[model samples]
Target: MIAHLADIESMEKSFRTNLINHLTGGKAVHLIGTYNEHHQSNLAIFSNVIHIGAYPAMIGVLFRPIGENSHTYKNIQANKQFTLNQIPLSMVQQAHQTSARYPFGTSEFEACEIEEETIPEFDGPFVKHSLIKMGLIWEEEHLIKSNQTVLLVGKIQYISIEDSILLPDGHIDLGLAQSLSAGGLDTYYQLNQLTQFPYAKVLADASHEPRRNS
Candidate 1:
C-alpha cells in the first residue's frame, strides 16, 4: 500500500486520480447552483467547498482549471451569486449525476430530474429537496499557479435549514438532516454521531495531586 510520488505518477491516470482524491479523506458533498446572465441555470456537485470564516460567513470552493466551458464558474462570475445545497442520503444518486458533463446551458436540475427551488431576493436556484441550503454572493477568486485551479470565495447571504436540525449553540445536527459525504469520485457515505466533547482549556493552577501506588 506504500506509494511514493514517483509511484503515484507512474500509476494509470484514472487510478492515480481516484487514489489521490480519496487520500484526502471524506469531504462534505454539496450541489452548487448558479445561473448566467442569460438565465440559463447550471447545477453541479462539488466536494471542495470549505468554510473560510464565520463572522462574514464566507466559504471557499475550488474549481478545476478553466476549460472551454466551465458553466458553473462562468455563471458565478456572471451574476456573482450561487447556492450550496446539502446532499442527503436519499438523493445521493441524483447528486452524483450532477457531476456528469453536460452541454452548455443544460440545466442539470432538469437533466437529473431534481427540482429547483428559488427564494425571493436571491439570484440563484437551490435544490428544493435539500434539508440545508445556503445562498452565497461571490467575493473573490484566487488562482493557484501550481495546478491552475481556481479558488472561489463567497459570502453566505441566506441559509435555510429544517427547524429540527438546528442546535441552541449554533451547531446544526447534520446527522438529523441525513447529510452525505464524498469518499472519492463516485462513492457517497452516510455519517453518524460518535460523540461530543467540550472545548479544551488549560488548568489555571498546575499543582499536582499525589497519586496512589497501584
Candidate 2:
C-alpha cells in the first residue's frame, strides 16, 4: 500500500516505507556506479531513469537527495560526462549492494567488486560488465523546490549495445537479451519473449525463410 504524506516528516516516513517495499522482491533495477568528489562515494540504486529523446539522444535521471553534493552529482558537474552501463540479469546482487556511502575517494569499483574502464579523456570510470554502455555529456541541471532533488539531463556521445541484443531493422530483442525492469517503485523483474509484434516501418530484408519439406 502507498502511504500518503502531508508534510516533510510524513513525506520522509512515506519515502522510507516506499523504499523498503520497493526492494522486497530483490528484482528492482538499480543505477550502479554513480560518483562524486567532496563527500563520500555516493552509490544508490535507482529505478527512476527514463529515455527522453532520440534526435539529441538525451536521458533523464531523477536523483533524490541523500543530502547535498553527492559524489555522483559532483562528478557530473566537474567532468560534465558520465557513463551508463546497463546491468545484466546476473549482476543484481552487486548492484543492490552498492547503496552504501563509502568514504571519499574509496572507489565502489573496488568495494563492490566492479571493474572500471578509464575512458580516454574523462575523469570517471565505466563498469566493465554492462551490455549497453552509453557515454553521455551533461546538457542541463534543473532544481526542484522540495529539498535537494535534482533533474539531470544528459546527451549521448557514444552508444554500445551487445551484438546479441541487436535485432534486424534497428530494434532490440529484450527477451533474448534478458533485459530487466523495476516494479511498483522497487522490485526488479526480468523480461522474456511472449510474442513479436509487427513493426510500423522498416526496410524489407531480401532473404527468405527455407520452405518446409512435404
Candidate 3:
C-alpha cells in the first residue's frame, strides 16, 4: 500500500527529518571542506559516502549544490582535497547537525559543538572523535546537469582507525565499533553480524550442518 500525500509543506511542519530513510547499506564516512570567499574554513559531514574502485583506492560522494552558489563545490574546485570520518553511535547527534545550511566561513565543528582536528599536512579537516577517518585528494569532479548534483571523486591518501576495530582477517569488526544505522523515517538502529559464512561454508552440503534425527 502506498499513500502519496499532496501536502508537502505540512509534512515538514511537523518534524523534518532527513528524507533519506533508506541509504545503500554499509554507511560511509563523509567529510567535506570548502573555503569561502574570505578563505575561512568550512567543514561538513556526510554519510552517503561510497567506494568507487579498488585498483585506485578511490571513493565518490554527491553534494547537492547550495542553491546556485556553493562554496563547498567551489572549495573542491579550488583545493581538490577533503577528509571523511566514520561516525559511531556516540556522534550521531553531531553528524546529524552538519546537514544544516550555514553561511560560508561558518565552522560546523563549532556549530555542532564537536571538536575538530587537523593533520600535519592535510588541507581539509577531520572529526576528532570519529572511529575512523580518511583524507582524500581530488582525482576528478563531475557535474550531473539534470539534477544539479556534484559528484566528487577522490583518491584516499591517508586513513586512521581505532586498533580495536581491526580483525586478523583484515576486516573491520563492527562489533567493536558500535556504529549505527537507520531503517524507517527517523528510526535509528544498531547492527551486528549474526553470522559470517565463508565461501566453503555455503558450498558445503546442507546435510553437513543439518540436525540428524535422534
What are the per-model C-alpha RMSD values against the true structure?
3.5, 9.5, 5.8
lDDT of 3 at 115: 78
Residue 72 of model 3: what lDDT? Answer: 65
Instruction: Give the TM-score of each candidate.
Output: 0.93, 0.73, 0.75
- Stronger candidate by TM-score (2 vs 3): 3
Model 2 pairs whose backbones collide = 22-186, 27-188, 28-187, 28-188, 31-46, 35-71, 35-72, 36-71, 36-72
What TM-score does structure 2 among the candidates reach?
0.73
> Which candidate should be chosen as best, given lDDT against the real structure?
1
lDDT (Cα, 0-100) at 4 in candidate 3? 55
lDDT of 3 by residue, 1-214 (tens): 2325665444664343344334344454444654555556676666556779977899888777646546666777777777777777787777677767777778888888877887786767778887777788889878889977778898989888898898888788776787666442244566686888665645444566668799
Error of 2 at 202 (Å): 20
Give a tens-digit lDDT track for model 2, residues 52-134.
89988998787777464366767777667777777678877777666677666777777887766656654446677777777
Q: Predicted candidate 2: what Cα RMSD to the true structure?
A: 9.5
- Better by lDDT, candidate 2 or 1: 1
> Model 1 clash pairs?
none
Rank by lDDT, highest first. 1, 3, 2
- Put down candidate 1 lDDT per residue, 88-151, tens digits, no spaces: 7888898899889999989999999999998796878999999899999999999999999999
